[model samples]
Target: MKIGVDYVKVRRSERLIDMTQYLLDHPHDLIPLTFFAARYGSAKSSISEDLAIVKKTFKERGTGLLETIPGAAGGVVFTPSITDEEAKEYIESLAERLSEEDRLLPGGYVYLSDMLGQPDLLRKVGRIIAAQYLDKKVDAVMTVATKGVPIAQAVSYYLNAPFVIVRRDSKITEGSTVSVNYVSGSSERIEKMELSKRSLKRGSRVLIVDDFMKGGGTVNGMKSLIEEFEAELVGITVFAESKFKGERAIDDYNSLLFVQDVDTSTKTITVVPGNCFDKE
Candidate 1:
């Protein structure tokens, strides 16, 4: 081991920096220690020490989790996460934005298209959602077309998983599509949605995300599509959920914001932190 301040020490420091970046870039991916050892021209022992430093820093910073697997075929995986405090803070801010009187629209609809365009906010929301399900073995993210695309993309980015779009209209491009019928949450009218057969694999763990859910009928439609594909429903998350009266279609889901009441007469919208903050 060469340990001069100007030589091996500098290289070690550089290695740690680069290794941390690599792990962050490839979240939820398993990387073998041998690969790191060869890449840095250092022994496995040195790589392990470097990872220990990274692991500690990540934990303390509330950045994420570093999981190490031992044995011959073992490797390390980095999974993104946020502290409860951070999640609550961010969601509270989001709820405030959604609660604005100007966001209220005709027929009690809340306008949300503008917020989806903000990349920074989406990144935080994605990290929060992805972090909550890191242990669920999320293989793919699913969402309905149009509004939910951005949310799904953001979550998939942090989860290091691909996203699939379920469309209102079937396209010839996506061959052999699987379609499902679901009642519209807002209107209570039956509507059809479809997804490409080739987009998801059988038995794969799927995380469903959406922009907004009212009565949860649309989400239930996606759940039906999951069943048709023989994929497992890991969980569901939504950016916001409007107030729904009576029984909802689905029972379990997490949301960043809940629209408690939207009074069109007074143009007042009541928004609050969703159930994801229940433990807090």
Candidate 2:
């Protein structure tokens, strides 16, 4: 409300706070200088100066990258990012928490539902994952059925893209749908998943996300669906992955945490940072 009001100039500190908040709210969006100037009833030169300060702080604090594109058709775009060191440190701590014995489930799956349901944690995870594919020009985020929906939604928020859900069964509400049959990682049974025909268009660049992985069959199935729609696979990421004994169905993907071992008899779980930080 203080912005874009009756040309009443605001204080420098107040303007900076509002401006930073605006940019944070609209990550991955292009905002023109004129828009900021009009919003705060300030001069273009002053707004530019304010942006410089915000950019410096963002960089120094490892918050993200703010880019200024010059010319009439260009504007400022903010990409939410985390420093490698910070991301590694955070992920390591997360891995540590997951290593607790109580986290081990009956079938070697780690209990991650509590963490997945947390908004703050999910937002941090989103920032870490979104930072990785900022340059991929992702049009949408994809996830299968119920469990992966939250992770997909979180990542989509930072990417500023819509998310599509793939269902285990085709729903009548979906109208016409596309289905892919994949081997179930846990049960090793062939299972089918469906996506709405209108969820994605041909040539759409999609990023797939999931909460966890064991045999990677589900993700592989999602990849097949991407091919079916003539869409591109920008990337695939999972929150946690178990140490699979058999050959995995999907080889190329990223995970935040790797479950090195899950001993149900001993009630122990060992978690470590996945290959996400290995690229660094």
Candidate 3:
């Protein structure tokens, strides 16, 4: 916590020890550049050099728990042997920042739709959910068309499961297919989707996923469609759920984000975690 040049002045004498400790304390949260810049407020090139040095030190010390995943949403992940004391500290810090009623929208919505695009966050959540169903016979993932794709894709990636898209309408692209009817939040009457009969094999276990839930009509219809295929509904998962959404018919599920609200007039977005992905 003792930052600034004063910390650096004495660093000329015992730099390596202090630097190694800093990396261990903030393993995953800091980007390499951010980590080094905080220590010295130095240039990007210098920070990169320092990261290289720190990484080498970690390897030589036999502490290979810090891993760097390359690419856009990728960074570091700390697989550590830390005590529950440290884990509690990290969880509490996130909870303090993320838990706020102001994040709720007008009516009863929470706006965490963006986390769907953050691969790093979704990957963590997906792994947790997929682990719960690992021994089960999950054959494929199902979801209503549109926004639900990302969650389905994430779970599919982790489970090595294929995803089946239940479209809102029959498209020429689908050719001959089976269709279903269900009410939607967007409408009260009913909506439809066409899934190729070949898309799912009978008696297969289907894992359903969606982005947001209000009424659960779309997902329910998805579940019913699985029944029609004589397939087992292994489980269902969502990115976010509105508390207002009345009794969900299906229970085995997970959610990453919880919508507090979406104040379109003020253009405010409020969200938190109702699911395990961002919880205490």
Candidate 4:
């Protein structure tokens, strides 16, 4: 019966692995202990012990935070986070890559599609942004489409919040929409952006994110839309911000990278870490 006992141990090990995977995948969500106990046919106490081990490992590795709520209805919720040392290193590397000559585009825009598309980079960005507002109760994440979608999604993933997209044009499928007019930061032309009325609830605390910012017109437009929805703008962040001649449309904001200078003719770009690293 030694083999049978070993098999039982193997099954328990498999259950632990599965439980950890489930918790990691469903960050910011409460999973009932009974659900897991029923799913794995294990005792609640055993599941608690397993989660304790998982939580310890997660803390040691700087993977994320696993919060346990005590009560009959309580369970576990994961909050993704990155250690400071890792965040600093990642941001520094990203600044170097962004400064590459070939990444410079026309009109001083940097080509960042590849970086945004990478799952690893997005996760890092999300964790960094989420860490900043960990203490705050952020109700939702908002971004102006189409480039801002990825960054917003990443941040929302870590924050365990839903995201809403603001479009340049209102779509009929969206039902009712609230439109706001603002100056286009790059073009210096008046432009309008809209969001679905049903997307954001009233009095929500929102965090805004975007891929890039210059004069902050698009971000300002989103801010205005948030006001129209009767929501509060908790904070604003961008992937990168350009050092431009004119004053920025908005003053309070954070960014991951600052494009100090970009020479399209020479194909040279200078980048530095953004306000996110600034000491408050």
Which residue runs does candidate 2 get wrong by more than 4 Å?
1-10
TM-score of 4: 0.93
TM-score against truth, every candidate: 0.95, 0.94, 0.57, 0.93
The pairs that clash in candidate 4 are none
lDDT of 1 at 70: 95
Residue by residue across 74-116, what tens digits does model 4's lDDT show? 9998877778888888889999999988887777678999999
Error of 1 at 40 (Å): 1.8
Candidate 1, overall lDDT? 0.92
By TM-score, rank the candidates, best first. Answer: 1, 2, 4, 3
Clash count of each predicted structure: 0, 1, 8, 0
State in Å the error of residue 160, model 4: 2.8
Off by over 4 Å in 1: 1-3
Quick one: RMSD of model 1?
1.8
> lDDT (0-100) at residue 108 of candidate 2?
69
Model 4: weakest 10-residue lDDT segment is 101-110
lDDT (Cα atoms) of all candidates against the true structure: 0.92, 0.90, 0.64, 0.89
- The C-alpha stretches of model 3 lying farther than 4 A from their native spots are 1-113, 185-187, 245-252, 260-272, 275-280
Best by lDDT: 1
- Backbone-clash count (model 3): 8
lDDT of 4 at 182: 93
